[model samples]
Target chain A: MRVLLVDDEEELVATLAERLEMRGITACWVTNHRAALEAVDRERFDIALLDVRLPEMNGLDLKRLIEAKQPTMKFIFLTGHGSEEDFNACSAESGREYYLIKPVQIDVLTAKLHEICAEQGDRQ
Target chain B: MNGSHGKVDTLGLDYFGRMTASISHEIKNGLAIINENAGLLGDLVALTDKGRPLDPARLETIAENIRRRVQHADDIVRRLNQFAHSVSGPVTTVTLREIVESTVALAHRIAAMKGIAFTFSQDDTIKVETIPFILQNMVWICLKNIFQRHDSDTNLTLDFAFQEIETDVVIVMNFSHEIDTAATKAAISEEGKPIILFLKAQIYNDQTNRTIQLRMPKKFID
Candidate 1:
């Protein structure tokens, strides 16, 4: 499965991608909102992991852009920002069921990704 | 600003609440890191179970990473605990030096990220009958404003000098880089007024109960 991860924290994103790769999942990573948009256009990803806070465009805005481009693509929010406000905002949308806080449990994410991918395939 | 009218008690509680929010965010972030690292390690265990030969070095690194995250979480909890105690008392004789030091320590990382150097000085001789929580919150808001407006290459310096004759402690908030002077001033006034107002309310509540006594100083040393 192809996965795209975006976060401004290079170390966190890099570490996360490496963990995903270790689990036999091929992942592409981007650091900014613009790069994420460009990546979504150029690549076919099964899932996208996005950070909520970005320099210009936030994750919610980027999610809208990616969803428009790839209607079938799955989205998960991976953020270090933990507030009741953030949680509520993230849960407001459907298809965005998975809101994982950083630093994530690789096992939990691995299972979630598999579940989402299988669910997507069944729906299709 | 309302603190100028001798209402510091209510402002103290508001300040405590804001600090609790920020510090809790910090602690929550730390916990998330630790959780993620442990999950990764658990994933590695699963790989081993599948007869996949995992790198011994990676295993060792993961162990070290978890230890580091635990230490980070501990530090955050410690800071939060100290901050909590600062608000437990309604009125106390607070040392200006300790308040200045703690405020600097609390805000230094945030300021540094904004490319602003957070600096402060202490006067051992300066002691004030003040609500420490309110004072710290006011100082933090000022620091946050300075850091928010600081240019990438400039440093924000906060100097404190106590006037012995006047019996007042003076804090100087200076910026090396210029920002929207009007906006920055407005932000300071806007964010700071509620906190000061709340502190005033608490002081009034305490006065009515006669639980503690508070005195208003006669001069402003800005």
Candidate 2:
């Protein structure tokens, strides 16, 4: 599956992108919301791994922008704060299963991707 | 002498607090990245011990990233230490380019948070004997103003140039986009006018000699 990863943390994004690519997933990484938006406009991605606290625009706003364009694009938000308010807001907007906290285990992230892909298939 | 002066002091304190907070956050984030990279290397070592070969390229990248972050952290700490000492005295011989670059680095997240592309374009060769902390405060105010007017997708660029006009160095911060009067008013009034007054006084002192012009375009966003 193809994935777009957006996070301001360059190191984290690189590691996560590498791990995903190692597992046979095509991951394109962008450091900010604007670039992510621009990336999506140019290419197609089956899913996006977004960091909640981004540079230009936060992940929540970027999620809305991305979802508006690709309604079927799967999302998994990665956040460092994991505040109750932020979690609750994401849950309300995109369901609780899509949000993951920092230091995310590679297995857990891959599992979530697999689950998202399975759900998408079922929906289709 | 009055509550106004108290508010002015408070505004200075607030600006200092914001700068320190952002500096600390950047340091912490840098350390966090280093920690994660180290952890990944540890994980790789364990995998290798289990007879699974890891990519040498991954190891190299991790080490390189850690080295770069360590250097970044050290630079920040050095700047912070110098800044603290500069706050000790009123005026000092300060490198304008260093202060500008450090300020932009410190304000990167804040500018990015507001969708403002904070930039520095200045001559490193220029050095000035000035009130270090007060000058930083002025730059901070200008940055805050630029961030206030930033749009969602806009990129705000700051250019710092030192011109040798006769016997003086004119430090100019060229910015894009029209200034919002209400935001400027609120920024000055809600906090305190002492900063602006301080800047004006400093400029006025050198008005016949040196000049500092902070210019902004009527409307532009990159």
Candidate 3:
């Protein structure tokens, strides 16, 4: 599956992309909302992994922008802190299944990706 | 004034919480990078078992990256510890420049996130006796306000000068574009009056140059 990772933490995003690539998943990462939007515009990504606390705009807001451009694209939020406010915010959204906390387990993340794609397939 | 003091206390705690959260996020990001590198090493080890030749340079790069991240995390924790100890004494002799530097360090991440260039320059010889925590809170409030109002890519300069005649230190915040000086002054007065009063300081907007000036005495009296 092709995925896009967006976070201001450059090393974290780059390393996560590398790990995902090693696992046979095609992943591309960007460091901010503007670059993320540019990436989405330039390429077709099946899923977008966004950090909840981004530079200028937060992940939730960026997700809306991306969804506007790519209606069928899916999103998973990555947050460093699992505060109740963050959880509630993600849960209130339509795509709640993919909100993962930072320092996430790679295996669990992969499973979630598979589950999301499978659900998408079933809907189609 | 007691009610105002209570408001300053609440705002001080809020600033403390925000700084701690931001620093913790930085440390966490460092750890996340190290974790990924370690995982990559494990992947290489697994590949080696299948007769894939090990690249020593790649291993070295991953190890070096982990070391750099560890140092990054350590620096963040050290700064955080310094910030936590800022409240240890109620009144102490502190260099004005040092306090400004510490405050800038605390707010650096938030500024960077917004792509705002926040810079500060001071005369190292200038000293003051004051409540460091409250001083930091006041400065942080101003910074937080600026970041909230301005968009990304804005440039802000904080210039510090000592006025010998007045025996006061002045911090002038300069912005690239014209801001609502009256509104900013009002906001600072509304939210920060207690601290300003407690510190026996003055803050006003200079409409001529579109700058906000925070003036504090060289020594404060309880």
Q: Highest lDDT, which number?
A: 3
Encode model 1's per-residue lDDT on B30-129: one tens digit a residue: 6665665676777778888889888889889878977887787788788878887776545566666677678876665465445566444455566666
Error of 2 at B82 (Å): 4.2
Scoring model 3 with DockQ, what do you get? 0.76
Residues A8-93, model 2: lDDT tens digits: 88887877776677667899998987789999999888899888777766788899999988888988887766668679978887
TM-score of each: 0.69, 0.68, 0.94
Classified by CAPRI criteria, candidate 3 counts as medium
- Model 3, position A3, has a per-residue lDDT of 95
Tell me how each candidate scores on DockQ against the true complex.
0.34, 0.30, 0.76
How many angstroms is the interface RMSD of candidate 3? 1.3
Candidate 3 residue-wise lDDT at B90: 69
Ranking by lDDT: 3, 2, 1
Pairs that clash in candidate 1 = A103-B32, A103-B33, A103-B36, A104-B36, B7-B200, B10-B198, B10-B199, B10-B202, B11-B198, B11-B199
lDDT of 1 at A61: 80
Candidate 3 residue B80 Cα shift, in angstroms, is 1.5
Docking class of 1: acceptable
- How many Å off is the CA of B89 in candidate 2? 5.0
Model 3 Cα lDDT, one tens digit per residue, A20-108 = 89788999999989899999899999899989999878999999999999999888988988888888888776456778887888889
| Model 2 Cα shift for residue B182 (angstroms) | 11
Q: Which candidate has the top score in TM-score?
A: 3
